[model samples]
Target: MVSKPSSAASARTVSVLALVAAVLVGAFLAPVVYDAAAPTPDRVAVISVDGTITSYTADQLEEDLHEARENESIKAVVLQVDSPGGSAAASEQMYLAVNRTAQEMPVVSSVEGTGASGAYYTMLPSESIYVTPSSVIGSVGVRGSAPIGGSSNEIRTGPDKASMTLDHREAQIETLKHAFVGSVMEHRGDELSLSREEVAYAKVYTGARATQNGYADDIGTLQTAIDRAASEAGLENYEVVEKEPSTRSGIILLSSQNGNSTVVVEESPIGYDGVRAPQFLMVYGQVQYEDEVIGNVSA
Candidate 1:
């Protein structure tokens, strides 16, 4: 045991000490690196849906919803709706996206000024809906003209090819109505006191009436909605953040290659060319240039 240490044995001891030092350094710096790389996981995303809900608004809502889903920091979603509804197609798109996100996280819809028709439809997908005492909700109906039909002076084609017939138009109206009714039944079924016919009748209600009839969860503000969402999601501590969604415009092309091929393309904004087909919309507005109501299309 008193023999002099060999050079090889001394070199091995030095190498072992260096290895231990490296491990200690890594342990000390690991948390710093992780903290810098990862965002704080105490955030809730709030997306605003103000004014008329066109394709543009739908795209924005979709962007925020996706961000909330992909980002681990986001704990829940709150849809701040202040719309009088718009094109039914856009509302449907928003509904589907919100519903999908709700499946992954808690989503609460909070009404601001008005959430009627398609706007209400968009909110239906949330886990719960919140509205102030003054908030206006409901108007679950479609508003659009029947498809236009042209005479034989045009190109030779099928009878109902240019436009749907009277019967066909009626069927389509029924289809839209049934779709709205089906969604209402599915989303607000157990809590809904109103019948299928009553809802399809397209009646608007105040926040108090809406909550009384089970159309809305409760009468509260956006803050209330956020607090409730956090509590329901088991988030004892969190921060509410309003995320700015991308506003760039783009075209969405959908193509089908069946025997009767059909290609549909839509723009996210009002096109320069006034070319658009009649859309089944849940819009509730009076047409007017300044103050006077035009034809009073508030039906």
Candidate 2:
């Protein structure tokens, strides 16, 4: 019942529909385009050292540290520690990795609960170390159980195959202890009020006491450490990226059967190539020894 629309009106209608479609598309894409144009924020990496430091833990931490070093977006690092420490070799590896990362950029440490022995060693390279008031720090020394001896009936190819001499074990322990103490002195000597002899005593210090004695820089939370790290990197607006240790079913630190002592089990089998080897620990808790453990056994 109506006349056909004019060609001119149809053209106008087509133009209007095209305009509306363009507007709708633009509205959807504007935010995306803006996001693409924006710069990425600088990042502060927070690497955690939880539970006992093992070979596996050390490797994971090293990977994180390496990532932070290689990534241009990452400006600084915060080592978040909540461990009683672990294997001597593993701890040393962690320390070396941390030290290398520190040389490249600012590295700060925050102790959440306990950072003792090897944990302390691992944080030595940090520019500043922070701890909570209740945090435990220090215990810078080494202890080891004597090697298990072969049975009298067992045959050995070499004199040292079955067991290392007591004197040799003692010497080895002394060497390890000296190196640990020396590293502590090298890093914290200027601030320390305690002497080398006192440090050799291997005492665990409360956070407050540690700060006063120069084992820790100040009493602060993990957030505080992150802020400090960002500040050190000259980042006013930065993002924090946390790298957590891999989860695995291994005994970390557990109370012994008697409930009075603690046993630190590393992720690596307690030995060399699956053989039950002597364990040299830079740990804070009381260690339980097996019958194979020689020397003055503690219960």
lDDT values of the candidates?
A: 0.77, 0.84
Candidate 1 runs further than 4 Å off:
1-39, 245-272, 287-299
lDDT tens readout by residue for model 2, 1-299: 99999999999999999999999999999999999999889999999998766677789898989989999999999999998887888899999999999999999999979999999999999999999888999999987775446457778998767656667878988998999999999999999999999999999999999999999999999999999999999999999998866665533442333322234444435552222345677777864333322222211
User: Per-candidate TM vs. native?
Assistant: 0.75, 0.80
Q: Which residue pairs clash within candidate 1? A: none
Q: Give the top-scoring candidate (TM-score).
A: 2
Model 1 collision count: 0
Residue-wise C-alpha lDDT for candidate 1, range 62-181, written one tens digit per residue: 877898899887888898899888767888999899889989989999996899988898888788899988889998887656545565467756654565566776677688878887
Error of 2 at 208 (Å): 1.0
Candidate 2 Cα errors over 4 Å, as ranges: 1-19, 148-162, 250-275, 287-299
